[model samples]
Each structure stands twice: as structure tokens, then as C-alpha cells.
Target: MEVSKKKPAAGVPAAKEPAPTLASGKYTFSKSEALRRYLSRKQARSGKRVSKAKRDEQKKKPKFVEKPFNKGTRIVSLKKRPNNYPCKNHSKPRSKVPKKHGATKVRKSLQPGTILILLAGVHRGKRVVLLKALKSGLLLVTGPYKINRVPIRRVHQKFVIATSTRLNIESVKIPDTINDAYFRRIREKRAKKAEGDIFAKKKKTYKVSATRKADQITVDKQLLRAIRPHPDRKILLNYLKSRFGLSTGQYPHTLKF
Candidate 1:
């Protein structure tokens, strides 16, 4: 049997087409329609007008009022106290003229090799091995205070000679005078220089081993000993051995006591 092919009538409406589906499976609105809907909601929110009763109530509210200043009231002024004022209640008490230890008595001038006691300066109460008395009446002591050239006036009168090797002393106060300040600055600078020197020495010592290789010829242990001759002997020896291919079993014969 032959099938007949026929066209639909022009007056009849075609069958409704199925809606297109996106990956999200949601119905999508046209750009213009979506924008129109958004603008409608914005207009609804912004178009609200203030009521006349609310406006009247706002107008009736009180405003901030400024108070008048009184000219007769007194104002107090604050100022800082002077920094040079002596410390309260800690002033050195004046010593009464003793029957035995009379005031203004000329004691024998301190000489070289005399162990003087530092009574008042930064190294106060500390017994220093006096090197020499400078023309300025200052003592040349060893250690950190030596660089400052601290004056003899700072030392207390309670100094005794160092007959034995061991000595014991206490710390002292640093004066705030101009001379003391100058001395302190000099001490600080010298300390920094000393610290730099120590660091430089350490750097030089460390550089010796770093430049050498394990397979290279053994280093002269005498040269290493001259560089550092203290408690770090073992450490330096081990480092030299590792760096210069020295035999592990061989003791470092160049180390001097």
C-alpha cells in the first residue's frame, strides 16, 4: 500500500513547540524584561514619600544648645619639674668631723702599684689595680673602665694594697657631670671598637679552615695555634684536620700550652 504525504491547513494553528532547556534546567527571562522587573522593584523602594505628620514630629524635636563660659573661674597650669634636681632623700649625709679621722687631713698621695678602691664613680667600690697616675689625677685601671681614664676622686678612701693575687670589689655609681659624660662616651666608643676587633679576629680564624679542602696538604698546626691559643684548642684542631686531610690518628704536636 502507498502512503499519502499531505500538508497542514494554513488557517489551523501549528502544534505548540516544547520549551528549550538550558544546562541549568531553569526558565531564563529576556534581558530587557529582567532589567524592567529590577527597576520596578527599585522604584517601589525609592518612591516612598515622607508623611506630613512625621515631618511635623521631626520639626518639633529639640536641637543641641551651647552653654556660656564663666570668665571668673581660674584655670591651673601644669609644668614639668627640672631634671637636674638632686634625688629626693638620697643625698650623701655630711660626715661630722671625727676625733681620730679628722677632716681636711692631707693623706699620702696614691702611688703606682697601689690597689685603689673606686668609691663613687661607675666602678665604685671596685678595687682596681692602679697602673699609673695621670697628670690629671686620674687612675689608669685595667678592664672596661681603663679606656675611660676615670678620675681618682671617684675612688673611695677605703682602698687597701693587693698583697695577694685574688681581689674582691663592688660596683660604683656613674656621675652625671660633664666630665663623666665625656668619659662615658669614650668608654662606649672603645667598647664598640673592642667588640669589632673580637669579631674580626673570629672571622679571620674561621676563614683559615674554610679556604682549605679535605684532600689538600695538611696545614701547619703551629700557625693555627698562634691564631687562637685558649679553650678552643680541640675545636680548632678538629676543624684543621677535617679541612686539610691531616691523619685522624695523629695528635696535633704543634699545639703550645
Candidate 2:
């Protein structure tokens, strides 16, 4: 009996042929060549030159991630009072001037017998007797000549005159006129007095005999311990010179002390 040949399956597709395997060969590479190849591949992978569009997109994205405030969060706010608050308080009706002994508003115009001290300005650190208070804000003085046209700004808060080595406020006086000429004259007189005092002391030094006999003097140990070269002084001076363009004086005394 003859039989028909079995038919192949209708839906099955043909399988692809396997690729041929490479033949085993002795592969060789120099150390430098192998390293160069590795480095080139690494650089090519890492150095991915970005396009401008990608960079712009990255920049447009928000950098920080914000979260909604939690229900438990608390808010606080503070407001500052204006600087004119005190002025407003003083304008109230009950703010009349008190009638106390030292509660006078005008301060009596700094009349004579009111000693005033030189508080600030060019005459700072000096004590002068106020002879009289001039209408032009000048001060007259018994010593150091009259300080012509001394401005009210130069006078201190309180004036006291030295009487018999005791300071008293009742003996002081105020002057009327304050002018450049008066100020110059007073300054000159003070300078002359200072010079005279200095010369007098120097002259006395020549006449005074030395009383101390030769003796071995011991140096203070504490002073020696403290007398180290300042570690920060050089660095600070250098910084000042570079930043502020300041120059130290040439005098050795000035440089150190």
C-alpha cells in the first residue's frame, strides 16, 4: 500500500543558523597599549559632551524639593516700634517740666560763677576755669589767658575750678565771646605754660644731686617672662600695610612702643 508523505507543520518558522565561533589564537598586547586603550574607552564613556538644550532643561528644574508645612507647625511674627515713640510721649499734656532744683530747662545760660570743664574738642583733656559766659559762646579763663570764643561744644558737662588744690564749682565763671582769635591766643598761652613747666623741670634736674649709692639691682622675673616678642604683631602689621596702605614711622620708639 502506498501512503502519502506526512505534511510539515503550517505555522512554524525556520530557525536562524548559529554564528561561527572564533578560532582560538594567542592574543598579545603591550602594557602601554593596553593602558592607552583602557584610558581612551573610559574617557569616551565619561566625557559625554552635553548639548545646550540638556543643560538649559537641567537649569530650569528646581534644585530644592519643597514640602508642605505640617499641621503642627507654629508661626511667629514681631513688629518694631518706631523711633519717634519717645517724642510722642513727651508731647502729652501731663509732660510739664518739673520744678526741682536741678530741673531748669535752659541751664541758666552758663553764667559767671558756673565753672565749666573742657569736655571735648581740641581742648580735650584740659581743665580751665570758666571766667564768664559770653553771648557768643566764648569762655574767659583766669589762667592760660582767655579762651576767646570757645564754642559750647568744647565745654564739658560740669565745670569746676581748682582753688588751693581743691576743686570747687562755685568759683568758676563763663565768658561771652568765642572767636578764632581768642581760641588762638588761649592755645598759645597754654603752649607757653607747658613749655615753661617742661623747662623748669629740666633745669631742676641739673641742680638735683643723686642720692642713690651703687647697689646690685635685680630684674623683675615677671616682667622678663612677659617680655616675649609679640607673635601676632608682625602678621597684623603686614595685614595692615597690605590692606590699608599704612606705613610705620621711622622712629624706633614709635615702631615698637
RMSD of each: 30.8, 32.7
Candidate 2 per-residue lDDT, tens place, 41-122, comes to: 6766899656679879988876554344675544333334466644346554765888556422324544443334343455
Q: What local distance difference test score does each model get?
A: 0.41, 0.38
Tens digits of per-residue lDDT for model 1 on 102-215? 333223545443444444546544444444433344444432222223322323334432322221222222222313223332222323345445455533222223222321
Off by over 4 Å in 2: 1-106, 142-257
Worst 10 residues of 2 by lDDT: 211-220
User: Against the correct fold, how does model 2 do in TM-score?
Assistant: 0.18
Which segments of candidate 1 are over 4 A away from where they belong? 1-109, 143-257
